[model samples]
Target: MPGIEAGGIAVVLVARSAIAAAPRAEMERLAGQVSGLHEIALATYAFTEQGQPALREVVANLRRRPFREIRLVPLLFPMEASFRAWIGRTLARWQLEWDTEGPAIRIGPGPNASERLTDLVSDLVETAGREKPFMPAEHPATTGSVVAAAHRRVLVCQGGPCNEAGAAAIWGHLRNEQEGQSLRTAGSGMMSATTSCLGPCSLAPVVQVWPEGTVYGGVNEAGIDAIIREHLLGDRPVESLAYPANGRKQALRLRE
Candidate 1:
């Protein structure tokens, strides 16, 4: 409560994953040493799984604290497009849900990891004596061949919204469907991977396809089969299930 002056600033560090607890702790410890501040508090939040104190939770905690202004600093390096979008939406949601008169919230740019992180990597490499090469004895060349042969690549959003919308089941179904396909030839290939939040929180269980960048929303177990057959194999976008590129909300017709 000592730091709750009318002009005091509170710093919030946003991490990429749950594993950044140690770094967050270290940041908080360092923040304490700074002088000439009305009040200063450091909090950390993660975007994806494997981290505790999620962004929502941290924001909620901050609301109860005494602060005139809040500054959010992303702990990511070279900030990905998806991350930027997610953060923007999250801040907007917070503004709508809470009283804005208490604290003025502002988001700062992500840490540029190009120079500093590279230097740190170099230091670590030097500390650990350079051996022959960082490689195993046997390398499977077939793995590359398999990946290269895939014609269609599907990215399933495994971020917070999708997870809450039962994305685990959708992911499991996608994997099962991929495995069932006959990959006897090079052209007949399909690959699926999971990614963080795709920025469309309202459209949970979102699936994106490349190179078309077609996104489908409200995907479920029943729709998985159609997606595989029509979109993946048949080379057609599922128009009915597609999410708009302009990020507008639309009526989702997911099967029961």
Candidate 2:
């Protein structure tokens, strides 16, 4: 697509939850160097769950801004069917909610698993490796600092359906548990992150424990404690809440 006029158009990079932060920062930095675009923003959403600044949220925020044309670029590797459906639904909702005088909306294709994207990821990894080492938090002694890589990463889905299904509460509980466990203490070896979606909306409010790749569905506040105690702390997944890998639906167990 052609570059937009200086003050009339905005470009929003819609990214997946996993690698969104760093790439969004990089894209914003690059977009700032380009002349003509009114504003460059980042909106992250999940295919099956509720992510922050979802498309609807992004549109609402953009309408409050000064731009007349809003361009949405999906940072997906492949524009899958679910992605198309979600984007179409989101735009339709926007059209229904806003007037014609609102900012014109446009959707751009994803990166499509291109070699360029692969190269970019490679470069990012190499660059990060060469950069300064990570310091988890401020500390007096350097030897006691916790490194994120050494921790077991827990990703909680905060996508739309999940959010509607009370994923926010579940996330809060998880965060509280994470802090309560003192996982960030020197050798505790546990960390948690909030993700946009995990691609299973029917099983909303999901939590995935990485390295183990165990996904728990329909998680609630009560389940959060079990997840932390059994999985994060004990290294044994709570199979009762675990999402089956074979695509079979288990009975919903978490409290609403």
Candidate 3:
């Protein structure tokens, strides 16, 4: 992004998706500040399946446009130690996936923008001694004894085995699917949580549904859709994909 040309440049504000993240409007405000860019977008590394677009998806779409270059502004700070390197490798992956001709891809904001962010951080740190008091009414942690009206509870295994077997991707897909099906709403009667393990470690990427306690094995994007649409929303477990191992057949029998 040299010579300071105005048009033909696309800027993307990229971050890793997280649960209950800060407002998208805040990021939009930042993107709007810069002028003369061909296009500006927001993308994430697919931590959650919310309103954010995947980095790969956004890059691909921007490449279709006649922009001279695509710039990815990393919005995530305090990321994992390997995050910067990971971003490089991810861009490499995108290049390999789409081998056709496209604009040059570069990561990070220009120096002036980076300096502004640095100054903002410095100002915040200069006043870091003042602590904001927590408000319990705004963010209550504990609930009363009243029983939940939810009809089903889903537990996605995050055990060591499952994590190695793609539990993170599964969780992301599940989040998107849950949102698509409107299952996360308070009145949806559907609840979901992450669990350490669900037994049947043989079925490493397991998803368990409550009431009947049916454990699903080898879940993927399609499996998540089936679990939400056919199982939770349809009131029936996807039996074919269900792995009733480790004595859980008894719990599944309750449904019969």
Q: What are the candidates' C-alpha RMSDs?
A: 11.2, 11.1, 7.8
TM-score of 3: 0.58
The best candidate by TM-score is 3
Which pairs clash inside model 1? Answer: 18-50, 18-51
TM-score of each model, paired residue for residue:
0.46, 0.41, 0.58
- Candidate 3 regions exceeding 4 Å error are 1-11, 16-22, 33-74, 81-121, 127-147, 160-166, 184-188, 199-204, 247-256
In order of lDDT, best first, we have: 3, 1, 2
Candidate ordering by TM-score (highest first): 3, 1, 2
Q: TM-score: which is higher, 2 or 3?
A: 3
Q: How many clashing pairs in candidate 3?
A: 0
Model 3 lDDT per residue over 157-191, tens place: 98876666656556766766576667865334777
Clashing pairs in 3: none
lDDT of each: 0.65, 0.64, 0.65
List residue ranges in candidate 2 displaced over 4 A. Answer: 1-146, 186-188, 247-256
